[model samples]
Target: MSDIIRRDPRAEWIARNRLHPLHAAMQPVQHSWMGPNGVIRKNVHGVGFIGPNGIKRIDRSGAQQGGAAKRTAAVEVQLPLHQVAAPAFYINVVPDMVGGRLSSHDRDLLGLARQLAGSDGAVLAVVFGEHKENAFATAGVDRLLVLDGHEFDGYSPEQRVQGLRAVDNQFNPRHWLLPDSRSGGGELGRRFAASLKERPATRVWQIKGDECIGRAGAGQEDLARPLPRLILAAVECADPVSETRHEVLPLELSTALARSLPRIEDLGAVAVDPAAIPMAEAEFIFSGGNGVKDWALFHQTAASLGATEGASRVAVDDGFMARDRQVGASGTWVTARVYVAVGISGAIQHLQGIGACDKVVAINLDPGCDMIKRADLSVIGESAAILQALIVAVEAYRNGAKRDAA
Candidate 1:
């Protein structure tokens, strides 16, 4: 054997091609090993063994891979803690928290509140009722206040205003920030402002120094005015807090809330069909494309997931779905919180349609598909199998939730 090193270009090419039959064999066996810091590292994919039929079988735990140092059991990220022992002032934020989780709009509002809070001031998030959110610290909330009561549940804006009033009397926040959207925030902010007899800056997109900029008169003009005590901020007002984590100290109102006589009667939620919800307004959209072989299964999956049905241009052109269900640059532009693409190749137009979506999930057999590139989560598998698994998972989740509630 010569001491000189010789590189094989063909072997290198084969190793680079993950889809190639000889790709895994040509690659170096890197399973698990201890890092420089003595932390165990594992290659999760390297743990799988060849089955009797030559099919690769992956162990969900990846214990075998842990021995190869390919995957870390848990990647713990420790962000700098922003502590406010005593606050000079307070910037109160009311998040929509749709689906019991922090929406992008809510995070943006909190970001704006953090800007106002500064170093001395603290960002206090006021959540109504019970929420499933557990990331208040990461969302830039220095304090967390939950107003949970049967009286404050449902469509009791008046009671909510009273609660806010009690909060106002206790903390007297320097500024109040709320999301200026249709999902309960805009209405609540306006009502709260009325109760306080203070004019709120509505539709605010930018806030600087002593000036706030917002949209006015059907969004045809820019309205710049002096910063008010209450602000109803629009989406993307500021980038969400990503650098540091806050203390998220729990706080309670020292004073009792004054119960208001309800002029509005409490009416329970009305059931509506997911299909009736427009793609633009739908929070979750399940979209299919030309690669979808079982259209019936696609529809069933969407129905099971409780997501609005949408289709790529190819699927629409093929007459597998309604023209109104098409989602692309040519169709309706969606702003869904979660957009699931099934068997979609991700055309430029299709990608453009879902550009405003917060999270994109791609399900396709082809690992190199364009949709996979744009997706936040990608599962390379048969669409049918994935959809079926999703259905089963959703059912299990619902059952578990019911059991917990019971």
Candidate 2:
């Protein structure tokens, strides 16, 4: 028995940490279910279990357990007061050029900052472009710093970083927050974090008390922690109620700061198809998976429904779709009102990307697939047959509505 015992390299490390062998070896398993014709099919992780009827069910226990552990650890781990540089929270607010107003997302950030500040700490709102002071003041900001000029007119990542740097130099704020807008705030916050040699939390959709939760780098795992040095938050669509008034502090634009930053000539904006809206902003999405047969029909149906087109990582990897349209952990994160998954068997990474979506509708051949189990509505059938039927139904509905109006 002693001669047959296998030597584990991690045994010494596990013993030193006082961890059980089972705990060290407990890795998440990729679960599969019986598909049509008795074929076994693998779905996303954390969504597979054996049912009493011999059919497999989605088991989210692994994800739930991991999340619970992380949250518990976050709550229990208390950093010393000496480690904290300051108690205040800083927020970067970018103006909405198209809307010609302060982005409401800024208000959400302000709300988060206020919550983090509590009674003792302060919340500072940094603004770019020409905006009325009252706009931010009414959003519960404690203080406002304005940086307005021609250089700051359009979205310039460099100028934003420099402006943020100036504020950091003056205030040395410990906590920084920015809206996770792709074209604006997201880029600014990520660049700012890189400049400071600090890791930034990006696309964060939820904040619980003092803790911030979001996807870790590479979209591998859910990360939750107390306020960090910097955060790029994905502001929810709903408006936050404001209670605190703010004091506006207008600052003169520093010509030296502008000149020091590399000035790149603004070429006219590149024209893109209006239909190809960023997945982040799309309220309705039609996503395709490996099982989709007619790519042309998929695009046509999505266009007909006025929905943004998206794809699974497998489809993108197989060159069936563009990488930008890939919706998964390693790809882009989408927070759509309605997400339609056609032929997609949900993977854990893909599920994480669309976790915040209001409703999910999955159409797959396999009834026991992960997407079918997790989706709000599931249609089990062949992709081509369902795609054509859905298109015809949409067209008929439109025609009927038109006749009724007439």
Top lDDT: which candidate number?
Answer: 1
Best by TM-score: 1
- Clash pairs, model 2 backbone: 47-58, 47-59, 48-59
Give one digit per residue, the lDDT tens place, for model 1 in 297-331: 88888888889999999999999999999998789
TM-score, candidate 2, is 0.44
Question: For each candidate, what is the lDDT?
Answer: 0.83, 0.67
Off by over 4 Å in 2: 1-98, 132-134, 207-211, 216-221, 237-239, 247-258, 261-263, 278-406
True-vs-predicted CA distance for residue 36, candidate 2, Å: 32
Error of 2 at 111 (Å): 0.9
Worst 10 residues of 1 by lDDT: 35-44
